[model samples]
Target: MSGEQAGWALELYQRSVLKQQKFAGIQSLLGDTAGKRCLDIGADNGVVSLLLRRGGGDWSSADLAPEAVASIRSLVGGRVERIDGGPTPFADREFDLVVVVDFLEHIPDDRGFAAELGRILKPGGRLIVNVPREPRWSLVWPLRHAIGLTDQWHGHLRPGYREDSLAALLKPWFEVTAARTYCKTFSELLDTALNFGYVIKKRGQGEGGSTAKGTVVTQADWQKGGAGAMKALYPAMRAWTALDGLLPFFKGYRLIVQATRGSD
Candidate 1:
């Protein structure tokens, strides 16, 4: 890939197949955001925040990682903040919507943070969340462990979430209005293999203080040559990723949920 193409690859990293699935899932529930006040939390690759912003919402983003804060700001370019993992800096009932992605499972005080989510949203505000769903019975478990993508390495405080358990975590002030799973068997298989390759390439590299937020949270972790290699193979990867759509019978490996804030 040319240097320009490599830079394009870096920008497009969040456009991965799995992430596109999550974005489609979110947009299905999100509908119109033209006049809404939205906040996206978690240090996801900033792609989620970018996708939502395209809906024309007044958007802001926050993360505990300085790297993510800088990265996300470069994309969304408005009101990205670096937080310290305490109470957030926004005002009470300050937002009409909040989106959480690949993040809740990492918090040591998740319930407390759920309260914080509730505290910042207006009555009847919307919440959209995406999380890993790695139940013990999941067929993907063996490969996941084989690739060194275990919860410990990913900085997960817990393995992941089930629909019920995740609902419980958001129970304090949100009512789950919709729930579903994505990243089914074929997709999981493809994603795991891709992750293994990245892990193999990125092996032994210092985590740049990202271990606490998950080691591979962004494609930036793929770095120079890794990004170029990924850009080269990206077309085949996208084609491989498309196989998942043909088989709906397989159980998925991640969950996307839509919820609404409850009245005080």
Candidate 2:
């Protein structure tokens, strides 16, 4: 699949309260990238690539999925490439910054990937990573399983990361400059419930049930309503996100890291 056609479905649901907060955090951590060479690893749909490019960073994209690589290339008009799960194809110290957002959980050799990220970054260059926090809150796991809202459908290898564990994993090659956990708000929880119902309903219809007269339903078609729905609800989502910010007692759903490569 070409880049433009890749990840269209996923982007539809990207505007939930949790995602809005996550992107805000990512933008804040990114700071000023003007004139810097930036690489977005696992650039799903090229959202980060576009964001960095808009910030004036010289951006490139890479992904293991051909569709995603194509989508990113189409979006950014840059050097887009497909990567195997092994070592990255870039030269040593090739970029001033690297981003791996919500991509670590899918890779089996996370340590090797971390090392590769370090290798491809110039000394003192930055690496920004975001991953889901695992074990979730005490209530979340039960709620998710009870409702069949699991992430297994998305091919998540592991649940997510803990702050200390993630720190330990990257400590060998990078210094953790900053780290934080972001809590999900009530509105996001409501959104999840609604998505749970939607997924269940879709699954019940069987593989071709979403299509008309036995026709196959494409991913984009299945998700066609998401973007418009999210757009209409964005103002309310932002308000919920702001409210979530005030509730420090909630369990965090995501962990964001800002680290710098150590001297070789």
Largest lDDT belongs to which candidate?
Answer: 1
Question: Candidate 2 — which residues are off by over 4 angstroms?
Answer: 1-16, 185-191, 194-223
Model 2 vs. true fold: TM: 0.81
Q: How much does each candidate deviate from the true structure in C-alpha RMSD? A: 3.4, 5.2
lDDT per residue, candidate 2, 7-91, as tens digits? 5533643655654566777888987888899888765656556656768878878776666666567667768877755687899
Q: List the residue pairs that clash in candidate 1.
A: none
- Model 1 Cα shift for residue 220 (angstroms): 5.6
The TM-scores of all predictions, comma-separated, are 0.87, 0.81
Question: Candidate 1 lDDT, tens digit per residue, 46-122?
Answer: 66676677689798999766667766776667699876556999999999999887777777887888899999999
Query: Each candidate's lDDT (Cα)?
Result: 0.76, 0.70
> lDDT (0-100) at residue 82 of candidate 1?
76
